[model samples]
Target: MTDDGFMGPPWQMDWTPKAQAVRDTLPEHVRKTVDAVRAELVTAKDPYFRGVDTDADLPDGMKVRPIQSSVPKGPRIFFFGHGHGWLRHTFVRRVEDPQIVVEEVFWQ
Candidate 1:
């Protein structure tokens, strides 16, 4: 295993149709930020990299903190993005697949 105890390869990433649509509608700057975040997430060796439990408050500023659902098992559902500007994207990481699927994108 690697230093982080992660075995196998890094997680792949994909975006749902809805999430892609939302991303397409984002302003240039926000879209760039989202792209950067996606790049970082895909390179993560651990599935829970930088993730926080959903119950916890989000971090301040442009930092990205994945918010994991409280469910004890099954596919992981989480979101990460700019906590302050409300640019959030929800994702699902299935147990069977080494992929991070972006489910929804929202900004306000």
Candidate 2:
């Protein structure tokens, strides 16, 4: 348990091939931003930390929603600001492994 009394262990973060491809295209500075986000995400009790709950809460040009097409309750797609653009990604929590799997990534 953490100092905050959170029960579970920190989640490991993994990126899908498609997500890696998108990440590979990012400029070094933007990649650093993504890495910073990953650092926070890996230790978060909730994978959706810092993410808004509804589309209505999204900032202009940002997107956040549940991906229905995904299996086993589906992953969540969310966006966060990176420089002038938004970095969008989808993540699913795997309880068995205590990991957050990033399924896709796009910059817009």
lDDT on C-alpha atoms for all candidate structures? 0.55, 0.58
Q: Candidate 2 residues 1-108, lDDT tens each?
A: 546554454676778888888888998877876676566556545555334543443344344445554442456665556234444444444445656777666665
lDDT of 1 by residue, 1-108 (tens): 456444434667778888889889999987876776676556655545444543233233334444544633334333345342333443354444556777677766
**Candidate 2: clashing pairs of residues:** none
Best by lDDT: 2
> How do the predictions measure up, each by TM-score?
0.59, 0.58
Which residue runs does candidate 2 get wrong by more than 4 Å?
A: 1-7, 48-73, 82-96
Off by over 4 Å in 1: 1-9, 50-69, 72-97
- Lowest summed lDDT window (length 10), candidate 1: 53-62
Clashes of 1: 0
Can you give the lDDT of residue 79 in candidate 1? Answer: 38
Compute the lDDT of residue 59 as modeled in candidate 2. 40
